[model samples]
Target: MEFTAALREERLVAIVRGRDPEASFRTVMTLVEEGVPLVEVALSGADALDVIARARRELGTEAWLGAGAVLTAGDAQRARDAGANLLAAPALGPGVAESVRQGVPVLAGVSTAREVAAADRAGAAALTLLPGSVGGPAYLRALRAPFPDLPFVPVGRVDTERAGEYLRSGAMAVGVGAPLIGDAADGGDLGDLRKRAARFKAVCA
Candidate 1:
């Protein structure tokens, strides 16, 4: 499947963001091995591009690997060159334009209709509501009302317990960070990541 198609189909994206690149890579491998469909590595961490590239090399073309927290065209291009199929940003920025130019699917973070419209105008594949736990599923429902046609992926603080609620409330998919990846960066149990990924996948289903 294509990037956007798999995103919408899976209805869940495992956000791999940790300070330790090796831990993050190991956690991502666990998720993939346990059947988690989509994964994105945030660029804020060290050796992020390396993580993306490694994921592509290890998981092969069937994997839906992407880059997150992208803000600039250069960042988007770097992600693209590293084999990122999708680009996600905290807000509408030059990265979205760059993704469009590079034919990469994008998920722009947004909180309001104005930002949603702006992201749409910039040609985003979907809109991810940052701080999703602040307003929870209710906020997604309200925001989704106006733009019924657009795909919405709610990120930030989303866990397994609430994944279904967000999807039930009309979000196209949900992006999970620490809750999904666990504390792998701090040498926490990597085995738990598989369980978490399975639970998340079940809920998103």
Candidate 2:
């Protein structure tokens, strides 16, 4: 499916930030098996590019693959070359412009209206409220009230139970990391991960 349509339909994105390439790949595969339409491999840890490449080759068009924690122009280009259909960053910066220039859709992280406006100026495809749990559903609702037309995705501290609240509060989607993908170092069970993915899908649905 098209990235935007998948985002709209699934209303959930599994963010992979694990350091182990094998574990990350397994997590993504399990998410795919469980019906997740979008997955993001964050660059905050090692082997992110490799994991993204693996997911791209393995899942092909089955899922919308993206790279997160993109903080520089070089990072943006590298992610694009590595087969990331989209890019996400913690804030609006020159890297976002680079991603746009490279024809990669991007979600810019923003916490306030002013930042949201800046992201709009930068031509972001959407906005992600970082550390979303801090603000909770009420915070997202308040932010969306002013920019109801722009898509808003909440990342950080968003669990399965809170996913529904965020969506109902007007989030275009909710990004869950460790809680959804589980810890790679711990070698979490794939069966359990599938079950969590299904639960998340049902809640977001």
Candidate 3:
């Protein structure tokens, strides 16, 4: 399915970023097992590309694996080669164009009206509202007023309470990192991670 469609249906994107590559990969597998349909491995994490490649190898070609924090054309290219079906950036930059050119759907990040417009014009599959907590749900509602047709996925500082609020505010989906993954990616508790994932899924439901 298309990334936007997956977002609308799943209503959540599990972001995995950690200092340990093995632990990070394990965290991703745990999320996938929990039925978190969309997962993004931030490239800023250690050996993120290796994790993506390994996940792709294990999950096959059809999984909704994504590479996040993609900043340049090289990042985009490397991400695709690493088996990421999607690319997400913190802004409308070279990576966005490169991802589009490479036929990879990209979640271009935006925090203002102008950035939203610019990302939409750049052919992004969707817009990721970075630091979604800064303006809160009210900010997202305001943004939707002008760009009602564009898909917006709110990221950052999204916990269980805010997830539902963002969805009700018209977010196509929400990207959750530390709040969901917690220290699971840093060799925390998978059992606790499972419980947290269930809670998030319930909220998104």
Q: How close is each model in CA RMSD to the real structure?
A: 1.2, 1.4, 0.6
Candidate 3 per-residue lDDT, tens place, 19-71, comes to: 98999999999999999979999999999999999999988989999999999
Candidate 1 vs 3: which has more lDDT:
3
lDDT (tens digit, per residue) of candidate 1 on 1-205: 8766787788889888888888888877888788876889999977999989988899887678889999999999999999888889888889889998888889999988899999999889889999798899998889888888889899988877788889999888999988888897445788788788878888987
Worst 10 residues of 3 by lDDT: 1-10
Residue 61 displacement (Å), model 2: 5.1
Evaluate model 3: give its lDDT.
0.94
- Top TM-score: which candidate number? 3
- The order of the candidates by lDDT, greatest first, is 3, 1, 2
CA lDDT of each prediction against the hidden true structure: 0.86, 0.85, 0.94
What is the TM-score (0 to 1) of candidate 3?
Answer: 0.99
Clashes of 2: 0
TM-scores for the candidates: 0.95, 0.95, 0.99
lDDT of 1: 0.86
Could you tell me which 10 consecutive residues in candidate 1 have the lowest summed lDDT?
184-193
Clashes (N, CA, C under 3 Å) per candidate? 0, 0, 0
Q: Please report how far candidate 1 places residue 148 from its true position, in Å.
A: 0.9
